[model samples]
Target: MPRFTAQELDAHRAKVTQLLDKPSIKVGMSTCGVAAGAVLAFDTLVEEAKSKSANILISRTGCAGMCSMEPLVEVCIPGQPAAMYGNVDAELARRIINEHVLSSQPIVERLVPSIEALAVAYDKSDTPTPPGASGPRQYRIVLRNCGVIDPESIDEYIAREGYQALQKALSGMTSEQIIEELKVSGLRGRGGAGFPTWHKWQLTRDAQGDEHYIICNGDEGDPGAYMDRSVLEGDPHSIIEGMIIGGYVIGARQGVFYIRAEYPLAVQRIEKAIRQARAAGLLGKNILGTEFSFDLEIRLGAGAFVCGEETALIASVEGKRGTPRPRPPFPSVKGLWNMPTMINNVETLANIAPILVRGGKWFGSIGIGKSTGTKVFAVTGKIKNSGLVEIPMGTTLREVVNGICGGIASGRRVKAVQTGGPSGGLIPEQHLDTPVSYEHLQALGSIMGSGGMIVMDDTDSVVELSRFYLGFCVDESCGKCAPCRIGGTQILRTLNRIADLKGTERDIATVRRIAHAMQKASLCGLGQTAPNPILSALRYFEPEFMERIAAAKTARKEPGIARK
Candidate 1:
């Protein structure tokens, strides 16, 4: 294989752009799409294209983030505008081939242009608020490629300016320079904790080790959270390129993707991307004809939520039961078979390529203070436009929940917005204007965890919601420490009693006490923020609990019914 320099890479990218510029039909083949029968649609498209002898390329890409409109298909004819058709099945796929592909007509009812496209369309006109925007403001720094390109094909990724960052970093920038750039970008760890990425890289870079490693944490276990999964499924190459750039910056010789086995499609696409990179001299020795010899491997997690923790992930990669160990000797100091390793989440790594290509300052200016760039949110639950929405940081909760997500479906009053999955907290309607930054969310008793935002309406019970999150923590807790295992279970039981309207005020106090202990004493993040939902709900919706308690008391006072 021939190695390409920076200029050569750009030229190749231009060529790919020209190829994609021509008329074509695109299919969303992400897991959601497949679940909605996208495979049959894809097969039908291929068959129709073959039968008609059309020269269009029938390509498969990752999730477009609008999962509610699954089986999405994008048709871009030479003369007509590109259109996205959602809820596409085999019938629609065939119609798309006949009408959009063969003819110049677009399917008007199914057209859902991307937010970026919408922004461009309304650049001169008044900026119309999107469908839902009740969540916090966010920027899409890490999740730029998700739902934007064909993840399965490297050429498609290349056409969209992928791998250019790797080329730039490897060809022009040194390891120290790359680290400095990341520092300037103020990029923080996206894997729950908001640790500075540069510091982690620098620690591993300075650590005394001949053999170093970089791992992408793709074991996203938060229920209702699928940001990592979407990125892995939609733009596997972006993550791959980010890992390569990370390896180059940290002077690592090897990289590993620690993804959950439950995400079979994500794992499959990532594996395919790795193979393609290797074949293209992007992985393995002397990449791009440079002295940077970085190699990568895939390590599947056996569906253990604890493995999402860095130490536990490293242990799992070493072929052990996924469990967390104490951290003072952090992963940067000793990790992944006792080597100096730097672990970054899939979203964090995906941002690396863009940061390198568009300078660090360029990224830093996109969001609010300290928190730079865009964030991709998996906005689900009680919303009309449910899927992924990427917005700049500091975007208000109201904007995300109401404008982008179209507010609560069917005009129901939004009760709260749940951010950060089981490990996150619920933000009441009163705090809808809160800016979505790591610090802002932390102040509201929440964290900007892998960007999962579940909208809740009036019908949703706060006590029940808290119970659900607490229960998840109890189940996924590794049980390595008592505070997490015991305290989590205790909190769950108390919340359950409250949900069942059988608890006194004392039980609520007990829940708070246990949550505090777990927050303070738990070994890892899973246990630390396990009580976030409970505490946040208690803070904002104490009336809801009091109402339930009052109802229980009223029942007890009336007749022969006994209250537990």
Candidate 2:
């Protein structure tokens, strides 16, 4: 409600941080949390707090990545440890208010260690702690404020050093200096490609344009991928601040957030964050009382997967059909009304704030070679702790599957792991010990696509999984090119035959030939990577396909015998 200068903002952070000295109650209110009945629990806590006349602050924050235990509630008393409870409801809310808030006695049955506390434990141990008994250690950097701060309140974000990065850039650093810091930090685009963020920003800045634009690609279409959505919902201001810093570096005066319409909650939170930011002198004219000025608006996408591509995203933002064009004159040169445009995904923008606050060298020293900083993954499917996990880049698949996610839900052997959604390939169980760097995932015939990791157990069939992913690609393909449109259909047919236990070696060979053509001839990323799932399945699980074919032959030989 008040416009703040640079000095005033700092003073306000000190005042807001003092509130932590008192008891506070925070409810997980993001999409995952709300779906698990967090809304009812939140209302109950507010009502019960009023009835009991409890002197506590009740607030709602974004998901902390543990979606398996939703309707989560966190309580922090002065002397006692901060406790997080999952699967909370109205009844639990009442008990928490009366027993935990009023009496200061924590409910052991519902208590889970805070992520920050667990990080301390992890730092002290050589071996990572396994999931289930304790939630996995998620080395959070981009998700530092998620599930910790009230997303609706700008002050909470500021208290945690949110816009200070933007302040430093606007008041102190030049555009080139910011790009150089990003380069030194080794920050890459988190939107599947792993391209250098610094290079893109530099190119956009150097491009010829009187007016430039910055676009935040929040249209996360990858199935099982919700990292971008959570960031948008839980820490919208981080993206805002990141964009402001980006706008300053790129010399862009206007920005746009291209989020899909399906994520209504994310859109709403972002819109609210934009308004709050404007009121606080963080978004509009003369931000932080500096000469630098920037404005932002939201553009709802139609849930097209191809729009995730830069050219298609730019076209969609300009009110054109969402399809990818040739890439000779990329978006950096001529984009969005024939002006230079710099586009980064939600997670990529979120990293900018932290990188600026902590020097580039500090971030660069965290992760392994070339892949610095933490990566947030939406780990789902047949896993005990199915939720979000953020670990350093060099962490092994074994650590993620066995330690963080608690191996398999059914306690069965792992069949394979799927990363990058429809576009990514499968990593067999044999490679579980492999580290999860971008190059390593690519070497394993998959990619680090937008951080969607689905763990599969032995009960699952690899051929069927490949078919399903290929089918999704076929259905979602933009159909702008023949290689992706027709090749995807042919690959899907071969996969269906193999999955049905009726494919021969010739059929397999035909599919492989088609896959290679699509990979080479497809116009955009959608077509080029559409056959990844099938190719990886064949590469790692060809024996299974042969076994199915043998069974089909035996069934045909014995007319009266039923197929096993």
Q: Which prediction has the highest lDDT against the true structure?
A: 2
CA lDDT of each prediction against the hidden true structure: 0.82, 0.87
What's the C-alpha lDDT at position 354 in model 1? 80
**Residue 331 deviation, candidate 1, in Å?**
0.8
**Which portions of model 1 show Cα errors greater than 4 Å?**
1-11, 114-116, 119-143
Candidate 2 — which residues are off by over 4 angstroms?
120-136, 559-564
Model 1: per-residue lDDT, tens digit, 362-383?
7786678988766778899999
In the range 1-564, model 2's lDDT, one tens digit per residue, is 787888888888889877657678999999989988999999999999999999999999998778898978989777877799889988899999999889877788888757556452222333333433464466777777888889998888888887889878877899989999999999999998999999999999999998999999999999988999899999999999999998988888999999999999999999999999999999899899988899999999997889999899988998989999998798888988889999998999999987887788877876778988778899999999888878878888888888877889889999889999998989989999988888999999999999999999999988888888888889989899999999999988877876786677788899999999999999999999988988998899999888888877776788665355
In model 1, where is the ten-residue run with the lowest total lDDT?
Answer: 120-129
TM-score of each: 0.93, 0.96
Deviation from truth (RMSD, Å), model 1: 3.3
Q: What does candidate 1 score on TM?
A: 0.93
